[model samples]
Target: MDTKRFISFEGLDYSGKTTQIKRLKEYLEGEGFKVYTIREPGGTKISEKIRRILLDKAHVNMTGRCEIFLYSAARVQLVEEQIIPLLKKGYFILADRYVDSTTAYQGYGRGVDLEMVRLINEAATYGIMPGTTFYLKFLPEQVNKRTKLSGRELDRLEAAGLDFYQRVFQGYEKIAENNKNRFVVIDANQGIEQIHQKIVEVVKKRTLEEL
Candidate 1:
């Protein structure tokens, strides 16, 4: 399937991806475009069930391999049940996270083998990929600080310590470097409006170019 209308946002928790996605969706709709926003591990009914299991703080002992497989399972379901169909209808699909999240969080954070992670991600995505991925870049320390200030309860993965998050951050850096043509690195530390403006600018340019 053509993915020119598929845009994804990636970042650690508290990196403001959800907010940015909401803004982008609103902006797209205001421009008279059909927009669909979905979150990874929990878009379709089946996927949402897997998402609950994956994020439950009670599942602390889940193995890295198991975690990756579960994530891939959810992803494949969302792709087959939701993403592909939305794209076919000419809707601009915005994903909160995608395959790269698995590479960063499961492969790097959990110390899973990179080669194995690559294969699983390829299988789950069925060769479908986002046309543009906006990575909200922020240091692990900054994310931790925001989490503490927010006083929100941490999920299983979010509760992973600073070292784990650091590895994930580094993984994202490597992935972005390797896929420069598809990744757009954005400074997430900026004011919300500032970041939104930058994303809108890039989205506008990309959509126009694709057209």
Candidate 2:
């Protein structure tokens, strides 16, 4: 096991990041590795409060700058309080989402300045970057299909129209292009078991390389 490695799962809404992260955690634990699973914007108590404000459906009037700041605040708390400490002790950290979400959603999706987004993310993360980021690629139409299948009302971010989501999708592709070494894109339209197996294969390969 690569104890010091940090792995993050990224994708569009309803792209199965939560499910895959859970499975990866279980698989790692079964291999006798200590795993710490954390979600962005809600890892710590203070951050969870911020997450509530950010995700509240009623907050339609929130400004883009405010949204970015709140997310960065939550990320700072999570990294300082939980992520950094755990990594120092050599734990395998699996994050559901991280800095990339901010860059994609707020930066590209909401039209915030991309450089400003990077600055905030760098400050919040304090250079503790994820060693590997698994990006589950799916189209906006697929997102709608999955959302309907789940039978859940969209959150404030998810409620953003298809155009916004397409922008976010493009943003993710660009990020993946620029950071090919750190990103492993998986086609998320496949079966759950197949997707999980592909993720496991990439993770195993990357862990060995890191070691």
TM-score of each: 0.98, 0.96
**Off by more than 4 A, model 1:** none
Off by over 4 Å in 2: 1-4
lDDT of 1 by residue, 1-211 (tens): 8898999999988999999999999998999999999998899999999999999888999999999999999999999999999999999999999999999999988889999999999999888999999999999999989999999998888878899999999999999998999999999999999999999999889874676
Ten-residue segment with the worst summed lDDT in candidate 1?
202-211
lDDT of 2 by residue, 59-173 (tens): 9999999999999999999998988888888788999999999999999999999999998989988877888999999999999998889999788988888999999999999
Per-structure clash totals for the candidates:
0, 0
Instruction: Report the number of the highest-lDDT candidate.
Output: 1
Weakest 10 consecutive residues of candidate 2 by summed lDDT: 1-10
Each prediction's RMSD to truth: 0.8, 1.7
How many Å off is the CA of 74 in candidate 1? Answer: 0.5
Name the lDDT value of residue 48 in candidate 2.
97
Best model per TM-score: 1
